[model samples]
Target chain A: MSTRFSPILICGAATLFSACESSTTTGGGVSDAQSSDAQSSDAQASDTQASDSGDGSSDGDDGGLQDASAEDVVDGDDVYAAEDALPSDDVPVVAEDVQARTDIEFPSDVDEDSVTDTESPDITETDVPGVDAGGPDVDFADVDPGDVDPGDVDPGDVVPGDFDPGDDVQTTKGPQLGEPCDLSIQTWCGDEAVPTLSCEYIEAEWVWTEYNENGLPCFCHPASSPGPAICAVPGFVGIDQSGRDRQAPSLRALRRAARLV
Target chain B: MADALTIDFDRSGIIDPVFAHFAIPVPTLDVPPLSGVVRDAAVRIWVDRARSEYVGVMIVRKLHGLLVDLNAPMDLQELALRMLLDEQRHANLCSAVVGALGGDSGVTFDVPELQQPRSAATLESQLIEMLVGTYACGEVVAHTLLRHVVKALPKSGFRLVLQSIAKDEVLHARFGPTLLASIRAGEQASWIDCPGDAVISALYSAQCRWMLGRDVVDARDVRLFEDDEQARAMCSVGVSEPRAFKAAYMAAVERVRRHARSR
Candidate 1:
């Protein structure tokens, strides 16, 4: 398509340059014969240059002359002779290329006359050529919304690998040793009401019971028992066999017990 | 009377004794005769020393029992036994000094009855309570008082005796905490928990009474001197003033409190 339009485009460019030169020389002090000679020499030079570069054919020579007349008509009436020269099959291609070039080169030439000529329905029909070249129009609005199932967007529908709801659940352990225990709060207390026994509170009255086999204070209970009992000394409380007490241990006695002295 | 009184140091029952090497030459009966106040004070100091020594004996016995009960590996038993001998020596030394000062009757206090273990809970608690009360509180207070006395007294046989006893008391004071540390580091760590506030409170109260002699109502009657000058003199020779003793007692209590908190 570009091959057939190259010669015509070249001829038109040459003719426009020649017309511009002739218009510039028309009011000069040169005589009419000299002016005509200069104009004929310039036109012949433009035609030769157009033929050499446009198509390498004799048709470019006549095309250049016709182009000059077309330029005169266009200057007076604002029209292009290249559109008439274009073949029917190549008309849309050539018009598109020309329109594109005009838009790029002379974007600021949007006079009312140019807009009316370039923006006509006939020029818009040329856009169909692009579609005919295999660029299909996609109408997203025609797609059925029902084809996409709404369940696909549901979070529960997606299954993540290695995910087990039970694995996230944690089992709580009961209160550890030495932790304070509350009788009311059974959860942390577990099976026992009190976490551990303390010497602050005496659970039972200490009595002077018979001695056990270990010869310890076996006051009321055995020596290993864990409860309050009267120690051998008056006004003293302690476990029978444990040797633990609320009072300070007598160092003098301990020395004797160890039999150091 | 002989020119110089000869003490029967050999009969004191300290085998291969440390103080045996010293040739203690007793002074004349009097450059000035022993006054009533000085005599009373001297007798009292000796009596208290004897009683404290006896208590020392009992403390070791309790420690031995505790070690056995807990099956603790540290054999404080032997050290405790040795401390018993040292206390006995201290008691005799105080008594001898009392005799030289004109209190010939020697330590007038009766043999104290055996005190039962007061910690009626676990064996570990009992051991801890005993250690805090005896070593941290009792012996520490004794060491402070004796140290002051040793500093106040002039360089004499009496000061030497108090110094010797004070040195032993300091070791006795350290025994408790050392044993506790060992227990904590060993398998018995579970048993050695920080004592609750109530136990510490009871222990502190007991320590204050023991240190200040508040537990014994007649302790004031044993004052070594009547006047300030005489009291100062007594303080110089291992008899602490009542106010100073109380202050030292309170300090010991605070120490024990801090020790408990750290645990």
Candidate 2:
């Protein structure tokens, strides 16, 4: 009957967008005019600290995307950066060390309608990975359901011991990283961990197989790890089954401890 | 059957071996017999989702364009592209669902162009609109709805397609507010107050109309089968749950509000 919120949902909620600390170049606002301020802000890095200096200068700092250094991503979703302090009824909160973002400025004077179109950045093309074979029969491999072992789950085995789900909900057991499963299962590993670790299927490895197969494996991951934390399945059913925001705070942790950042 | 459009989508190209650790597993469909009303209803849901996913693509493309035009952070722009790719793949998956149901993909492909909010005044307004509508509200709602649908699925490939699609939306949903914060950083003005934000409300209403196929005036006007008797009947087969989808929509919108710190 305890109604405690998970630290991940409470502290890392707004920052689920990304992981790691990167150099950010700001150039936007309600107006179409671009700001000339070339000053760059270092994206938030490390843990669940939403580092707000309280000056309101660097107000909404963070979005530290998942970087190559997985070592920095100790707290799953917080890997991106610290989010604004969220409204939690009662929970453990991470300290946000936000610096002043005073340097990045927006254009106060904007020529809305008459503005020249800014040349869109050409992001390097990643090789599209789907439907390429276009063969008579789809390329999905048959899944071996027997490969999944519930005994291998036991969230304690996958998630770090520090995290607490906050609410009264008991920690649910599920398949571990590389353990065969199907659509019927999602990221169920760290339903009770901080900075939320997901125990679900990885998207990149998803392949079709003979019908009614459950060949996919589950892993612990952050609810939303930037870059490639084994892209989460379609969505998370890891949280509350009723779909209540308060109840489903069990974001993601990791599929396997070693694979992703 | 020859006239039916091909909607089955499968990933076959070389998957980067680097990501093999802790890779997500997929399920296969146990093809079910298609007939009468049940089959028809399943087709309608997948077709409708296909349209939404298609629009999701257009919206992200436009959003990427806006980011480019505004000279937003390169990282933000890149995230937009990532979302675009995800939506494209998702569209293919939805097509696969339609094909499995023995339906036409064109029914979804033929839908209208993505519409911009009439209240948007500039590229900036438009960008925020995309963040709120597409990522914030739409993705958030879809994430929750897919969770339920995945459980209801009859241990078939239908479940695999949906579950896979659902996971991608988590980051997309979180990206909504993160991008918004990046845009509105240090500024006290709330983007939720923008006139274009009203469009988000209209979108929810529009979804109800599409699902129920009529104007929704009040609670009494809801005609979708929410009763438990039909729970396993229609919803079990790929159709959306009226109450669950709406609740998720409301929850997503609230998350946006909290993120904006407007309350």
Candidate 3:
């Protein structure tokens, strides 16, 4: 998907530049033919140079590739033609990315948008993914609701083999002791963009999402949403009537899980 | 495997979760590898202590519920709640002690018997059984056992917590007498004639018998009445004291039996 979008971004930048040049030339002494001929030739030369320089190195002066790497430049994007490409017409990319990158943990008692936790150890400050279980300082990272196993006693429950990275994210085996992988996303390099996904232990509760349909409550991703309902972990197998997912285990069940009985 | 009752409480949201309050501090023992002897003893001690404290909490809570059940005025109810809360605090303290010594200290219970009306006639007998058989008999006896632990365990935070819990139990025992007097006054207590004497003596005897059965208590340790060296030690056979607790208890039992027989 990312590879297909690259060429379209470059073309859009070029179009914007041409429009500005044409508008400026209209107010100057240069004839429309001369002005358009010069700009068109310049654009062609830049495009040709970009294609020849192996992943747009010659067109490196174009700030479009400023954040992307050489292999991911315009040459990589050439796989998608301009006709097949669509421009990023003020599509609120930054906002969506911020929203999509919802895997980060937030403060327990703060607003969803306020990313900093005054009393907590900041997620960005720690390189180690999960809570430093043995650290002097306890950091309760927002657990991934799917990874919780309070009574993970059975050896057969071990997540099979080492984790493999792929597109289909689903669980094939239950969790077990010391199984060092996330089951929801079939990945191994551990989503560098969102390190929380690959932690050894994630303790999260079930959360309901606004988009739930069929009147069935759904466990929501903490990364994309923030509400009291977002972190309420549901029990073994029950959902609330309002269609909002419930994570509050029955008091009796909680006691059993805690080994109080 | 975790107990089912604990699971039920975990789900009910009635009591706060164990992790919310208890703190497990560093352990002081020099436990060796695969040394099941030391580890097993430690684990046993922890389990026993947790079990003991749990009964205490259950008793106090049940007693509190009973006070409310009897429709005893507000003053009596308030007194019972205070005692119940004290018992909970003791449970919490014991839980912290167990955790500090590297034991999992959550309290779990099975789903309670189905909720029947509070006014059921059988409730009184059940209350009597729980109080005489479980609390006074079970928990008070546990205190006798833990008295040995306080001495055997090396001086540390765990011992300190045990001491605190024991002190609370001493006060808790007084509740029996107060409630017993009230039951006698109301004539609602189960046993006919000298019911208070019968219940108190039975509980005291049952407690002694149960404590002695735990295998930890040695007969040579009975020191509540004697001046012998073994008697001075914490694990002494204080339960066998001839002239002190047992004498008073036996006399009370004889009185209740005579009254019942004459009637």
Each prediction's TM-score versus the true structure: 0.41, 0.40, 0.33
Compared with the real two-chain complex, what DockQ does model 2 have?
A: 0.02
Against the correct fold, how does model 2 do in TM-score?
A: 0.40
True contacts kept of each: 0.00, 0.00, 0.01
Where in model 1 is the C-alpha error above 4 Å?
Answer: A1-261, B1-32, B104-112, B115-122, B185-229, B232-237
lDDT tens readout by residue for model 2, A104-209:
1112222212211110010111100011111122111232222333323322243333433453322333222344433323323233221122223356442212
Candidates 1 and 3 compared: the better one by lDDT is 1
DockQ of each: 0.00, 0.02, 0.01
Model 3: residues with Cα > 4 Å off, grouped in runs = A1-261, B1-40, B105-121, B146-154, B185-263
Please give, for residues B47-115, the per-residue lDDT of candidate 1 as tens digits.
555544644444455565566556565435445544554554455555555666655532221111223
Cα lDDT for residue B176, candidate 2: 59
Question: Between candidates 1 and 2, which one is better according to lDDT?
Answer: 2
Classified by CAPRI criteria, candidate 1 counts as incorrect
TM of chain B vs. native, candidate 3: 0.54
Over A122-190, each residue of candidate 1 has an lDDT whose tens digit, in order, gives 111111111011112122123222233222232112212232334212111222223332211111111
Q: Write the per-residue lDDT of candidate 3 for residues B1-263, one digit (tens) a residue.
A: 21122211112234454422322122232222323333333443344344434444434444556555555465545544444444444444545444544555454322111110111224454344344434333333333323323333333344444534433332233233334434546553443223344444433332322222122311222222255432232112111222232222222223222222222
lDDT of 3 by residue, A1-261 (tens): 111112122222222224323312211221221111111101111111112232111212211111122121111222211111111221112232222121112123223222111000000111111111121211112222223322232222233444334323322122222344322221111111111122222354222112211111111111111110111111000111111111222443443444553
